[model samples]
Target: MVDYSTQLIDGNGEFNVTGLDNFMKAVKLRELGLSYAVVAIMGPQSSGKSTLLNHLFHTRFREMDAFKGRSQTTKGIWIAKAVGVEPCTIVMDLEGTDGRERGEDDTTFEKQSALFALAVSDIVLINMWCHDIGREHAANKPLLKTVFQVLTLQVFVLTPLEHLEPVLREDIQKIWDTVSKPQAHKDTPLSEFFNARYNLYATIKQANWDASKVREKLRRDIEAHASSVRSAKLSEIVASFEKKLGQALAAPVESLLEASEKDTWSSIRRLLKRETDVGISEFSSALTGFELDQATFDKMVQNLRDYARSVVEKKCREEAGKVLIRMKDRFSTIFNHDTDSMPRVWTGAEDIRAITKDARSASLKLLSVMAATRLDEKPDKIENVLFSSLMDGTVALPSSQNRGIGDSADPLASSSWEEVPPENTLITPVQCKSLWRQFKAETEYTVTQAISAQEAHKRNNNWLPPPWAIMAMVVLGFNEFMLLLKNPLYLMALFVIYLLAKALWVQMDIAGEFHHGPLAGLLSLSSRFLPTVMNLLRKLAEEAQGNPAPEAPRPPQPLGSHNFKGQTQQPNTVSSSVPVSSVSSNISSTESGDEYSSPQLTHRRVSNVEQAESS
Candidate 1:
């Protein structure tokens, strides 16, 4: 049902997709759980849904075989087990919806088949053209909507109560927004509720305001009122803020609030994302065509994401529970809204860093504390983990040395130091996978952090190339050649050579493959042109020691068998040249009492994690 394949190659009589090795594998999936994943072959009478299924599933339930009958063959859900041993597959060919009107009560199984298929399958592979994504009420649209409605309901039932809270709120808010809340019904007498609504407006209306103005106002106010604000209580600040908001709204005065900020789509997205986080994942039919207003959506999404994250972390190992308790205590103090922690200079950098750092720490601390509590241990150990994780993109001093990171060449420069728990035994492949995901996320996060600061770092992430990146690559590569020759004028000449090489190669392979596809794809990649380009970059990088290391390419990895689009594959050999100091000599990837490094940390960490359960 869920097609893991990317393409369906067309041929003389039918698609030549059967030539693919995966076609064999797919046939086996047809019967994996003994519950045949119902795949509905749907399209206009001639968009080739049936033809596609017949070829894909190897079903002979009467298609336009050219050698068979001329009339329409299937009437209801005609299913046949996949021919090959790919997997247990059920191919359900539904009557085409776009066919000419047969009779007044003539029932096509499009709607019914969709409902039935969704209930039973592990996946539902909707066969359609790439062009059908946005079409309104296209032949497959109703089927998709019905299936979605059904799935959404199932999701709500299976999920927990806290998970459903945000979804419920989103529905209510969406309805109120679309219907305008009847002008707040002349304001509630509850101060907490009123202020909450007021803050929501502040968040919405000021969403697009320039930071500079706000910074200036904050600075002036802070300097003028620092002495007077020393003894201000938490409740007092909230009250003051509410009073200011009420005056601003009643007077319609133009302050720092940005007029151009409020947008409807963001509101909808906020609500949608929040609902998804809370696991509601579907809207009540009563609010189907409703439009959202103001800041309703953003707040909802933010709240739900935060809550879902909280719930999931609480479900981690017992040790994580204790960590959450400590974090809650810390956050309660921070919630006092005291301005002392705020920076003196309102540089956007400080504000962004402080906010993000606090948020990240709070989240990790919560998870760690929860784990600790659940495991029945002191929450203090979580502090070490929290601090270590915060150093994700930065260097850490030796616990014994007590020196700050980047104390010399780059006191501020981030260090590439990561190590698994010392002497922790890796036990299972499943544990290995989990740790690997954490490592991969950390690596990608480092890259993101570098980019955020206009810094450079090495990471294996490679996906869609931005046009600017292509131009920058050419410029940087050509410059290396120009520098060697000491001639700036030769820059354009070198760039031309690069472009010409690329153009000639594109015409040679990609052009031929446009309609024929996959045929020329491998050639283009394996061609000398690509190799030549790669060689040129390697030379350039070698020439400049300052150049950032390219992400380790994963083209030929053995571990990555799934080959999903945009997924980075696992490589056969991993070679990293991290500083030896970065390796925790005290922390071994094994509990064998034999501390030594292998070619690299491969089977050792996994083995250690597995041992922890026994230890």
Candidate 2:
């Protein structure tokens, strides 16, 4: 009983999209979809077009009052739903044609409105005065010509028996023949172009007698229109649903595939099922008005499920194509970053062999996950086979190595896996073996580089000589040590020389410099040794001449606190007042030359000298 009415177009030829939308919603016209029918009325000014529609379709379109005299009434196209009609008819009342308000020069709105009515309406009622039926200048003639040119459908003339002459029908036929036709339908007859012609009064009496026949015709026409529209829209709707599902599901599936957790495939299956179900539900709701058969509905739903699986398969294939890059990335992530996700320094303490094993295992797990589609929720031996055959190198030995011992065939020699289907497999066993080989080949340089760095770190931190070398020095230099101990001034001079040598060593970072190789270290030392020694001598001479000594250098900082470029801080110094006494005490207390001359012990000895000077 809802009365929904809206002006569809203004007099200025502008369409009222907002008003139309509101009217359509109010009338629930969209709910009908293609099942609805449209009926429109168009004729000359004051031809009672609106009055005829208001009576015929039970619409409340505004009609001009006879007492108010004839003029423009409906300014534009007005749309309203028919109160009671089969197949939900919508009616439009177009503005009157050839009005004095818009002079004869402007038949633009008339022609445009007529064309729109013919294009959209299933039934058009052209209301004209009975007196203007055979007149050459009848106002409805141009409207009929417009309809004939665009389309020729069934026509019903509503006139009295007196005006329904044979010549009147001849004039209508002449108008159709004279109207311009597309080349495709130029020679087509009017009867072939249109469905049927009926005199209104006679047909109404005939319809009253056999109403069921008339109803059947109307039903057939509605079904034909709805079927054509539904067929075209069905494909579009399914395609749109598929596009939406893919857009929503692709990224998350790719991410989960990359992660490859324990339940990754299960999680993906759940996700696909959830999304597909939602799509099917929404698609079903959208096609409810189409009244599709059960088989068609089930087929469409199955197609959606198939599309979802295809999307997963496509994503798996894409990830498989980039498996090598992902494997290398996984290796680098585990190898380069520590347990806390910090970059590894290869400080000689880390177990590179165990770390390489773990990293390869993780990469292998990624390969196993991507090697096949697991929608069946079944586990495979991809990981175990790959690890044992490729990583552990447990393949069959060559004939020479076998030496009459029986051995199993290589597991990775086959192009497929046991108990796995061809469609489900993305990467076969042989392909995985080849990929692992390439992965190891690509990552070998990183392992070698880590080993080199660890070796360098060990070399740079080794300042003291080996225990055997220390024992040799103690045995070979025992006589010299005794000679220096007998002469106190010789001992002091040796102590002073030792202090100078230690200072130069700290400043130059001799341990770090020698890490490259002994030859490189010696070459570097030879180049800079003399100039450095000359500079030290000049400074000592300056201090001896009573010039204030330079400030003492700060103690060496902890590892990672110092600059990485081998720049070392200068060593601590002893007070000049107790230099001889402190040197004698240090030499007496020292257990061995190697221990006493070490950088750590040197710092402690200087700290003791400073404390003694303070006390």
Candidate 3:
């Protein structure tokens, strides 16, 4: 009259297979098939095996009463449903070894029961008393040996009672050391055999009984719903996380930038570390709504961290770009502007070496601000980007020599006019310094061009006609007014002035006096006064007559204004007097309103008015 719900098999190797079916049915798990895990427990007689299973699984397996004596309580295998675990767990209780009534022949029953449990179970628990660890027939040893020899499909876990001496746990390690020998294969250990057996059992179980196909189905389910997993909602979550990270970083990054260049990156690294921890924790909590398993959730966390890092890095680069602009402006301010912040019109008097050296130092200091990234993970990359961007061209040079140096430094300057470096970051200090030297060279070359431009402008603004042309206009009587008489004296004076000017120009060219230096500038200035005085006299005579003064010539428009038809046309005339001062203004903000007009150009208007009064 055995209770089928409690006892799955009776003594004498009689397996109550129907008892197992009935118990599973009562628990509503028989039809569930492979949607559950099977656990079995075995140990020495009265080693609290039944009590342990009852407490652990919350099952009603009968335990032996100490007063009634130490007889076997579980006669065979007792199966029951686990109370608290997920997916319907079925726990199997095996008969204890060293039975008082049974003799040595009982080993046959123990081995058969263990084999049966191993065949059906995924995990088997081996329980033993602390005192029995080193005993000859330490019940667990023979049972474990039987399972190993038989190569049963189960993973065995040893359960050591806390009431036992701590030293007894050493016995478990000792036993494993003795039993974990190579099986039939040279390098194969006993654990490998057990693992292979367990995997085979699981495969068979899945094929015959498991309707859910748990592992395969989980994989396919994740795959089928991958788009949903990576949905626009998830993207929005990532973007939100990035926004939070950015907001967290903005204040600190700005504070770091306001400091000295050397301090900026170091401060940013510290700031990033502090903010990243808080950001990751918050982001992880938000991800829990997706209800993913540990593995999937951890993978998503890693991807989110990677994305956040990239976004932060991109922002850091943009900030670095702004810093680079500030740095270049600092260098240019020192090199191309005076203490008054006026644009430098490079006269030969300025010290080229001192200005360039200061600019170089400032540029280097600016570069040092971007020596590392916020993570300090990609210093080389950050430095390279900053350096490349600073020296990248904004304005093209005007001369052939300038173009030559630019071509050597940057091949793309002519096409895109942007000089970015190739893929790899600049690594060594030598490499960085070398690039800096090229940049310094370009700056110095630019300064030289500026000086040459100013010099050319000064020469053109005070330009005079050739000595022969002046003689023709003054002495040959090809003037705008009617000449009543030919004056031979005036002709002689003009001839003498022409010869002097021709000699002076030839001598100046031979000595390179017009090239530069204060003496050369003075000489060039003195030579142009004669033409200005002669033009004034001629204008005065014209206005004295009833004829109005000829309109002053206007500068030609720039090259792109109109198409050329290869014709010379007369200069346009107008009734209104368009003074050069009124046409263009060059007043500096720092200057007094009346102080900085374009006096050289304005002098033409004044000469016109004086001539009108004199006439």
Candidate 4:
């Protein structure tokens, strides 16, 4: 058989991880889990602590020989499995304390081994010589002091019945009285301070190494130990499964939400059920070792499923909290770009009304998906209700219209849906209505800007005047045209003026400035027109006066080397001023109802507009 013992901690206080792993595997300790018990023995150097463990639990801890004289035997802490002990008790043989070899000043390892034993062991056996019991400076006194300083534990004193005189009992009581107690246990009695006293030597000698009584005692001790630990183990198991469920559901649910497909909730339900089923299967398998009854097992499994469902619900609610942001993003994605994901030019040929309806419909669908939990697969008319009520404006009749006979009541007038449970409702009917209003109000400006852009595109492309205006101009200017043709100098002057006007028009982006409206365009033109003309006049006058005019800056090279005739080129210009009225109107409309507006919403809208303009 494989040796099931190893030095757990070496003399230098380092844990032997590899040796411990091998020891655990040899002992099959993992199969015991939390059902096992730990029993540790500690005392003065060469005082037979290892011998006592070997006798009581049939362990193979090395013992000191009397012929070799008194010295340290066990170094650090050595652990071994009890061969015949019931419920799988593991025994620890701690290094002997107060040896002349280590010197008087060094008790660090002694105190450390004592504390480690008390911390991990369910039963600690302190071995001391019978003669040293009543001494003022007993070898185990300092060890007891260290144990007492950390935590209050039930101490057990084991001895042979023949040596257990009344005086020895008094010495044990006196030792307990001398050890300093924390304030919380200062008034406790000796009987309460220590576990029961036992004649361990007699018990071992009477049983003749059969260990039948020791096995029974160990079984009881392990049962008591398991009782205290079972609840915590159960909690740990549930907590681990809860964390796994959350991790499994997080990514898939987030992707489903972003896609916002028709069957998104159904997909999430399936995912949750699958993950929870896997968790419950593993959980039940783990609990099988515990041998729990049917009711308790069923309760734990149900709790796991409930926790998994709660995880999905929590994810839905968290995504619902960001519903407005998601809706805005969806609207932007559909409305700002075309089929190929290229930025739209808002050409007049595209139908703005149809595009706006399609974008709003998409956004509303997202809101509908998030409004409730549909894990039961029961289909509800949430999307249709929202479309008819909010998008189509067919749910809420006007007050006057409602006053008419046989007028139907508002469908979206309630706070909750008809079939949805309160626990499952992420967003209520009223909240959806309010959100739709805000979404429409916020998105209206994009549509308006698109319409304005289409108008501007049409206006900019029209190079020819109407036919009637052309006729009138030709008829009215016939005499002037003839006169100009008769004089070569006049015709040349007219050509120069035409060239100057065309150059100014191209350089200033005059057509772009006039696209806003008549009054605003006139104001914009008046602001820049006079200064441009005066600068041109000044430059010409200086050149005529024979003063060296500043060298004209060279134009940038065109992308193509060949220059084609009959095509008019327009200079690129970035407009610094955006029309303020459109911006103000958009902001004011968003703020018309304070109930729907927040500082964050306003700031976000402003930032989005700035980003759009920049792009």
Candidate 5:
């Protein structure tokens, strides 16, 4: 028996969102947030729409008084907060349609009120007497048809046992009997028509009403309502969960990274799985408060697991890089220092072989740490994929080629070694030194870039107070001692210092400093020499252009030799005095010198004889 203030719209049908706002405030809708759900009822005049809502939700919405003779007691639309629902529920009582008071001619208010309720409510109850279901002009039918056009409407039967539990579905024959009438082939009997429509409707309706499907949809709707009510809260919860997962993973990965290279691989696989399980377990526990259905819960669990897996994979690689850094540190330490950590003064007597062996061993061990990236699969497979990614830009040199001390090898020397060494075999100290140097350079560069980016971001965001502010406070503050007047020299010195500092800060290029380093001086020298180098190259190119490339010699040609350079004619040794008939007949033998005087005349005689044969 909770008291709820009922909100009403007057009979004129004039309402704005402000009315809804006032009603929401009265119901404490803002306080309920996403935990609130709306239930609306629509039915004919005097059909117990408000009465049903009052009983179901423990709301005291105004109902019609039979003694007073009903004349749309609930005019327009009415709303009240539910008193006894699990979630914060708002019950909407829409104006009844086809009222005797309003008459059938004007059902505009009824339609408008129904639309308004349907728009705002999570679930709508279409209240109708069992007898009125088949009637064409029933108030519920018109509203249902109207709602069907706009909403994804589903039918559910509420029983005395529970609120939303579905009743046993009627048999096809029983459904047909209720919706149909027997007629002697009256176009197609009304029963047949109803049965055809019923069959199609049953497919969609049954799917929605299935126990599992109903539960899933309800869970989704609940989540949707909760999201709308408290979107910020849910976002905060998810962010908190992600933060916890990251924190949980930090320790194991850090511990694995701190380990000696020889022990890193096996330990990483174990630690990665353990930390991933922790993250997923924590996320799952966090979701329990939402009270999701089994399907949704399982789906969320899988999604979290996948997220954990990706995070684990990335973290494993990063931590592995740390191990490589450690190995490089060891190699550098051994190569550059004596047993006492003192800088080495290289001498002829020093056992270079022993020192080099130790350095090589350390580098190899570091590489081994990188090889163990996968938790459940083979190490070699993970090694291949990881090395492929790390060495994506690297081009391997031929096995026969050995790089000099100062010369650069492949970015990852590991990429150049196609064959994995046998357990007993070892790579040379020179190779190890080259590889370690490259790896160290790459890791240091990445770290420097990351630090620079973070610094830039901080500068942009200005998380801390600027340095000038402190100076300004000291110089400009109201001091009882009158510090500024008493110390003119100090003020002038401060001004000079500020101007100098501003000039330097404005001109500073931190990123350029990192990228260029000691190379800046050398770069400036190169820039000065660049024009001289280009002019020298141009002069050399001009001098080299004096000798043109010779043409290729052509092959020897046969006589008549149109293929020769100048198309030379053979000597006309035969006499032209012979008859044209003889010259034409003997043209083939003329090359054997049967004396056709002119070669041109003999050719013309042959051409004339050939043209006559064609005609």
Candidate 6:
């Protein structure tokens, strides 16, 4: 067992982030005793998982911090105690995997995080990215597969409420006094628990299993315990208990613990199937209670109880949810926003905005306040707290009606922020598989270059010092530094030097020693013109980047190609309307043999996909 020392490094450290930030995080975790479980963020680079965690968990993990022209930013496991979280609830932000664009051969961190999560985590939350739910080879797939495989090794039978039945788990409490029937409801124990035990003993007997010495020693002890059994139910199980089946039955645990995950996946699948409708095999599994063995059934029943009771804190939530939501609604009403969905919560009343451009920031603020209030800790910075307030309903519209703002308007009146609904989180998915593929190709090229460099260097028996690269980097510094000196002010300094030379010539009685000579005048003229020329060149370059090499226009596509028009295609629909970005992209990119090239947007919005396929 790895000793519980407060020093295991997380992914942030893997990326070479150190110093005071690391020290403070370590200190906080150690003090709170919250560094036990590991929770990883799994997704492609720039997926906003880090941003979301940082925003939600109050972490300082930087999002997409790669310098211009750098490879992947996140390199390894970064551990930190989730801020505003309970003790022993550590969040291990893992380096996202399957960044095939980054490099293919090195998946050391991915493998490492999988093993770490399996070994240490009691609850490994696979954060369902609002996007990337169905894409094959999506960051979640490999990560989930690893989690599943390794989880096989560390199996313990746990019956959590969410495992057995989901419908019950989702039920809102009718009343507080009314018992939501204790969450762990495994009353009728599976008869198979006893039957399976009998079969195990029979298998052992058939194998001629024996620990003769242990049996002889325990004969009297067994008899004494057996006599104390009052009920026939447990007695039979106790008598038939054999040790070997523990290994066989461990993988599925309840088959019920999977109920939640499976159900969650299925729900996600259907939702994906409907929206982008990548139209994979329509074959889907239907849950049939009768097909499950009694042991499987009983375990399911038990798991739901545990999950609902503790993890979900179903009862306590019922009480808190009502009060908090009401306050949230008031804020929403004032802002003309929807109460149920804004983004997050605000710290106090003053941090709110009448109408703001920064929705993401607003949401973070809402979350900050809610989280802070929970722990009774003051929020650190109001800047991010703006975003958290989105969730708290403290964020709303400027008006009671659309296109309007001001007083007596519903705090959540106009409802600019569409609530996420009582279902899946809403986000814009950049289905840029093609873009990613292009990026992957570039990375692959770079990797090949790197490999060749390594081989050539090795063959030449050449050595490069760590500082040598630092020195080599100075070449870039030289180019940039030279460019800076070429600025007009520095050019003027050179002109001054020429004037000083002219003065010497005049003092020495040299011929034609004028300070205002044609040469000096021309130099001044060039200096004045150079800046404009440089500015023009920079602008041209920027515009070129902006318009990139006018993508080689392609032949028109067949009808259903994503190139076709969406709902707003009709001339009549153009009442000064813009095409819904998601639909427009789907229609637009379909024809381009290279489609997945969406600019990543981190802002959370009401997903039109869910609404589009609202079956």
Worst 10-residue lDDT window, candidate 3: 197-206
| Ranking 2 against 4 by lDDT, winner | 2
Ranking by lDDT: 2, 4, 3, 5, 1, 6
lDDT of 6 by residue, 1-615 (tens): 121222245443333335435645644645543223444545455554555555445566655743454245555655555554343445556666766554667666666766776676543434333234345454245544455433332221111222322321222111112322245633423222211100001111212345343333323332333234323533343223211122222232222122222132234223322322211111111113124456854564453333322322222233223323333333334333435655433322322333322332232232222221111122233223233233343544443355534453332222222322212211111211122234334434433443454455443343345687878888768976687587978678778777655543332222222224547645544443443334334434645565323322222221222322222222221122333354222222111122221222111122344336645
TM-scores, all models, native as reference: 0.21, 0.59, 0.32, 0.55, 0.36, 0.22
> Residue 506 deviation, candidate 3, in Å?
79
* TM-score for predicted model 2 compared with the true structure: 0.59
| Order by TM-score, highest first | 2, 4, 5, 3, 6, 1
Over the full model, what C-alpha lDDT does candidate 6 score relative to the true structure?
0.37
**Model 1 misplaced stretches (Cα beyond 4 Å):** 1-38, 65-71, 104-108, 127-140, 152-615
Going through the candidates in the order shown, the clash numbers are 48, 0, 0, 0, 7, 70
Per-residue lDDT for 486-591 in model 3, tens only?
Answer: 6666667778788656544542332244446658667654664454345445444654674535334333222222222122222332233445324442221111
Which prediction has more favorable lDDT, 3 or 4? 4
Error (Å) of candidate 6 at residue 123 is 2.8
Clashing pairs in 2: none
Give the CA lDDT, 0 to 100, for residue 17 in model 3.
76
- The model with the greatest TM-score is 2
> By summed lDDT, which 10 consecutive residues of candidate 4 come out lowest?
588-597
Q: Which residue runs does candidate 5 get wrong by more than 4 Å? A: 16-22, 68-70, 153-306, 310-370, 374-615
Q: How far out, in Å, is residue 509 in model 2?
A: 6.1
Best candidate (score: lDDT): 2
The candidate with the higher lDDT, 4 or 5, is 4
Which runs in model 2 stand beyond 4 Å of their true positions? 1-222, 395-408, 467-494, 506-521, 527-615
RMSD of 4: 17.3
